[model samples]
Target: MDSLKKKEQTLKSSCTTSQFCFFCTMKEPDSPQRRAGLANCFKQMPLTDDQENVLVSSGLFHIAMAQPDDPEFPSLGIFECMASLIQKGVNDEMWLRRDQNIYIPYYAAHIIGSYTMNKVEFAEKAVESGVIPPLMELLRGNKMSWVEQRVAVRALGHLASYERTFEALSTYEEEVVRLAMDLASTCVDVVYDNFVGVKDTRRRAKYQCDLLTRGVGGFEMENCKAEEWTSQLQCWSLYLLNCFAYKERSLNLICEEGFLRNLCGMWGGLANHVSPAGVGLIRILCYSKYGRKKVAELNEVVESLCNLSRSSDDWQYMGIDCLLLLLKDTDTRYKVIDIAFFFLVDLVEIKDLGDRSNFGEAIIKVLLLDYHKQNKVKLINISSSKARKAVEDLWDWNVERRRKERAMSDEKLEERRVLVGLIKQQASRLYCLGEIEEATRKYSEALALCPLSLRKERMVLYSNRARCRLLLEDPSSAIRDSTRALCLSTPANSHRKSLWRRSQAYDMKGLAKESLMDCIMFIKYGCIKSDQDQTATKPRSGVKIPYYAARMISKQMDATWLFATARSRIKESDNQCGNDEGQYYREEIMMRKMMDNRGLSTIREEPLVVKEDINRRKVERARRISKRATSQIGLPHDVGVAEIQCGGPTKRDRYSKFSSSDFISF
Candidate 1:
């Protein structure tokens, strides 16, 4: 006891500041006496105007709590030190007047956030220490800096993870909901404003600048710093919304307050950070029946989502989910089916359906549910044998010939051609709907019955058949059919559909030379197929279609070349270019080098040496692109489309109506 007393005296004599005293005192041996001594020391320390000293003391308290089992440590005392920092930071009139020591509350928030992590018991104790009020206060508008606001909301998010803190947060539910809505509205406004007057050269220029530097909101370059702060605030705000979205009360409040409207309005154009969280929130709320109805009632919402699903790959899954849920309602099924069926068919063709192959099942449900809604005669039940028979009869080769025989004149040949056209149309629909085998059979039947006079129609059948064969994994047959269609074409570029399909077939068969040539021709011809129905929908009206088409062709072309080059480099590094494979590969590589092109979504991983070589080539390509872009457009060129900048939740102006009362001061 005498030696311990001497050690304590020596530690106290060496302490130069309250921060040092706080740590030196905590370093004592474990005992009830030590806990009492630490508490008394904290209480005796004068309130230093030095924000760093108080912040450091809070840091020491957090460290002490790291070992909860230490008998000398007291969780309650540590929380008190953190709470004291909060009280001093907020209540200190001089610091508040000068705004000099705001980091005190910021660090206090960090301590509270860290203490609550994976420790539910500490959360309950911290709540009892009046930590919630200060954390909540920091989230209020005009109460703290952007960084501080983000830290506070993040701390609350951690606290809200615990059942106790979540309940405590619910007590202040109205303010929290309002804040979340405000942040959501800001994000929505940013995206919507991006499309406003987009045709105006100035707005388009500003939009581009915003995407690159996030400075378009004020048209000043320095606002880029504000952009980061805004992005962080928006992220955490969505997080807070996700935390609050689980309960029925919060769900109702969110829906009642226009969160759905903002979410739907921005679905077409959300920033990278906000899109995932926004979609997640929509998915969560749509899980409820009332939420589903609210969404279904908003025709514009449905329209935006359908448009988004068609254009953006990022939101397709969630868009499909929300569509499926809305389709469950009998009254809305037909309307949704009309808008969604086309893209859903497209999605079914490319994406792995996994268990959600019920996409087809859902269509079946919609057909059944809306059987009486249409004024026309209801079609045969999709599942019944009669429907199967009708489908078979429609595609049967003999049935069309029999109908033609009844004409008994030269007109009968024309009738045969008409019957062939009908069969081809049905086959095209089946192929798009992902019934590949059946569509192939129908296409063959149509071709067999087609008269020589219907030469154009025959070419289309061959092209359609080629697509089915490609999807069905018969590359050789697909190539043959596509080649046949190309040979019988009406004009130079009129066979683009056949050409592109043949390219895909060549790619599948590892015939990269043939594929690259076809892709180049497709791009040369505006990238749209001759068949009107087969063309991809334009993302926006009045935008040139060829630009996007060229972009896609470029991407696929690069993908093919990368695969070919990497394989050749690995297998035939020193081979002469006289061979069929080597000649084509060498020419294409030369073409790429001259154009200084780089690939997106390359075909396969390369060996380390090949990978390094490709990377060096890519860097050189990018440099060339940058220089060319500057010369031509005067703006930095991004290969991908630039996203719009949405202000994050921390934008001060959005929540400026709320005063300091909204934040916790105690």
Candidate 2:
């Protein structure tokens, strides 16, 4: 127990010393307590790379979580201390050579790579300062284990993703590509050697070979083929060749070099390994620039794919997508569609009626419209047995979906009812308090909860809310809601209220002429029903008086020509019967009295027929002028009269003074 106590005290003291050293050397004191606490904790624990990583990660987290609002945060200091530790550990020769300490440098590299603060610069500095040499050396070493290589390779890939490292590595592109290829090649060879003749290893080697061939142009399939190569390798070879053909589009490489022939050869040997995805890739390559020149070779490959697509029941859907992509160019569209149509016809006759019917529907929907529209194919002879079955199946599915939807809608309706009731209650309260804006908002919320199918009720709610919006001086929203209300309303349901609300909204928006028309309609349709009800309730003796009174009221408020005539008559009557003229008639002698009484008569004068004829002539002239102004005369709408006629003489013969030659000169 005493020996353990002494060892613990020594560990605690060493950690304290390290903390003090970091603070002194790094000159950052922000997370000194956290650092000290972690160090002391480590003293009581076994020192493993994971435990050290926990401390390192804790430090990084503290730095990352520091906020700009906290004046006393030492995030920069923490990052500096962590960076220093990583640099020192990676650079230390003793640490790098120690077998047990290998994990330290590896973890350090990981930390450097993942650090959020200027990570790219830090990684570059580490690499440029030769800190990554040992790791790279281990990666290239013959005695290096597979696990170590995997780690190194992953780390390098991560580093390469960074822009700075990518730019730096671009200068040595050939070297980098060669190194990556060699590592992948070595991995492939090792897998093959270890497994002897195992199919799985051959498969793994094929995958590695594919990766190696990514940017390496000259590394072809012949160099990688071995006696142990399985169908998997052939698939990979086909993939690599397709990729190369895709990049260069070299007809020579595609045909003369036997790229498509080799790819097609693999179809028989590796049909199972070469799936629809692989086939699709080959299809794309064959339609590429280089592949287009080698039409015969391209056709052979496409024919092989089409055959596989037709024969393989497993991946036929993928084959359809490949056919669609290949047919995107106009040149191949008709031909590809023809082939696809044949396949679809075959699908219609398939033994599994359900799948056949479903596929038939999909093919018709995806292809028929395009084929018929572009190629003028009638599809008159197409099989209807599968199509009819598909439609029935689709109808059944729709019925089920609609049934579920109705049930969901019922639940939503119940929820909406409760929400609308709450909104209405709130709106009533707000309305009482003279908060019209808030009241209108609540009313709008209530209306929005109403189902669209209930047009009559929704129109009422929308019209009412629109009025409230208009009162709140929000004419745009008012107009929108009012318009919606009118659209929802039916002729049988009476849209007068909606029209009235819209008229109010339009009036508020400075559209008085439009508003007047709507208001007149509202008074004519909406008020007539109420007046009739009132007349029905009234005694028979009072009916005539009320009817006459309603007619007078209608004349005053209506926007028709009758109202204009009434207004003109009122203006004439007021002008003739002055107060002086009325009294003068009473006091005058016989002849003068007769003249005065004629002008100031109590009875209203009917408009003279001659005056009416003159007014009619003026209205007709105005209409003619308006029509002429609006009619097109080979000029744009913005062109002025001067621009249109260029100072032409009037039709009243103003040009009679001038000869045709003088007019032309002018």
Q: Report, for every candidate in turn, its global Cα lDDT versus the true structure.
A: 0.52, 0.41
In model 2, which runs have C-alpha deviations exceeding 4 angstroms? Answer: 1-98, 101-143, 159-166, 178-189, 192-324, 329-666
Q: Which residue pairs collide, candidate 2?
A: none
Instruction: Give the TM-score of each candidate.
Output: 0.48, 0.27
lDDT of 2 by residue, 521-568 (tens): 454455545556777867422111112112222232232211122233
In model 1, pairs of residues that clash are 133-664, 137-663, 137-664, 234-649
Worst 10 residues of 1 by lDDT: 640-649
lDDT of 1 by residue, 196-220 (tens): 2122336443323333342333322
- True lDDT of residue 319, candidate 1: 71
- The C-alpha RMSD of each candidate to the native structure, in angstroms, is 20.6, 37.3
